[model samples]
Target: MNLPQSPNNAPDADDDLEPVGPRPRPKGIYALPNAITLSALFASFYAIVMAMNGRFETACIAIFAAAVLDSLDGRVARMTNTQSAFGEQMDSLADMVSFGAAPALIVYQWALKDMGKLGWIPAFVYIAGAALRLARFNVNIGVVDKRYFQGLPSPAAAALVMGLIWVVDDAGIKGVGRVDWAAWSAFAVTLFAGLSMVTNAPFYSFKVFGGRRSVPFIVLVAIALGIAVVSLDPPRVLFALFCAYGLSGYVIYGIKKSRGKPVSVIATSTDEPDEEGLHR
Candidate 1:
């Protein structure tokens, strides 16, 4: 009803219209990537359960499985263009379980538990390092160099701790809690891994290898040989490889420092240009 038309024939304002509220958040998550993350979380849970049962070898294997799944989920999310904030948060939380708490608990249960009060030190330090590392990574994701990680990644640190257990357990070492040398070695490795994670040393992330870039034919051959070697003696070889990697950050840091190169991987905050796919 055009009862009170203005000069431009505008309609009279109504007083009965309901005010619009803020939009509701969407409920569901992307299935494929999040499912992989959930699987990783389940693997961590299984590892903890296995550790409780004194099945440490199985527990170590479960953590490794979780690491593999953890690595895949992000790639899968990017590949399928399903990278969501939800998936990112889920991945970080799953990582905390798999790499943070699970390794600490497993290592403690295996060897550290025998050390009385001293045992909890390294275990607690390891978990704390994981928490700090994860938090730093999340905050620095966009600013840090893609070629390098700020420090030893939590998954790799987890591997360092779990690999010690796996190698000893595979060697048929029984009653780890009673073995002084083994427990001491576990303590040292766990401590080293924990400290390595919180350092400013830049670790090579290997992100460039799988991307759409051309590498030498020797790279493929090297990967194949590496796999074959790992398959021969999974426990010993994996532990050895991870051990080398555990020390690599400091080596790189030393080299960079000696050369007077910038050690931190973080980009300068001049223009703050957002790179595509960097935030997730």
Candidate 2:
């Protein structure tokens, strides 16, 4: 007959080890980046409030301020090594409010509201596009080429629309006959900005500048000059810059197609296990 097994036998030890479930999320989120995101969200809300009060220019400025804050939060998170899933989700939600809903509502109030029910359609379309764009971005963040965005980013699209309003308002162009033209212009820009958000065209993402990259001294000089030029005529200069950027994706797409390069913005599938379902 076989002897009885000891309490510390290998099979008993294996049985005593319980299976672990999936790891729980960290106990607390990083605060700084989320605070910045909340500030951006407040800026968006302020933009909407100012728009309602007929302070369109101030509202436009608020959107720009939100954009600046939005840009900072991600960099801050990355730099401080405090990135978290919560921060990413918060940032996207803030972006939707600031870059998507705020712009649509502001433009509608500034121009589209007077066009009857038809006036609101474009705004709704824009809101929808922004939602779709943000959702796709969240899902595809791991899959896309870091150097390029598959469609116009929502913030840039908001800039294109708000920039037009800012420049026109700065020029004091909202009287009688001018109001009608401005309204139509706002309508067109809003439509273009909204539709562009859902396009397949690839927009250049300036992600290449991050990390330990060194820059030439001339870059600093250029930045100073650019700041001075913007100071000289903030509305006109900023609007012109964003307009060019808003159209750049089509330019890049056309160039790539003409050169016989595959123009699809989707990053190619890789052999890595995590990337299996991430082709787009």
TM-scores of the models, in the given order? Answer: 0.87, 0.87
Which residues of candidate 1, in runs, are more than 4 Å off?
A: 1-28, 270-280
- Which residue window of length 10 is worst by lDDT in model 2? 172-181
Worst 10-residue lDDT window, candidate 1: 271-280
* lDDT value, candidate 2, whole model: 0.87
Clashing residue pairs in candidate 2 are none
TM-score (C-alpha, index-matched) for candidate 2: 0.87
Residue-level lDDT tens digits of model 1 in 198-223: 88888999999985789999999999
- Candidate 2 error regions (>4 Å): 1-27, 175-178, 270-280
> lDDT of each prediction vs. the true structure?
0.91, 0.87
Reference-based lDDT, residue 161, model 2: 87
Q: lDDT tens digits, residues 145-226, model 2? A: 7889978999999988889889988887664123787888887888888889988788999877646787788987888999
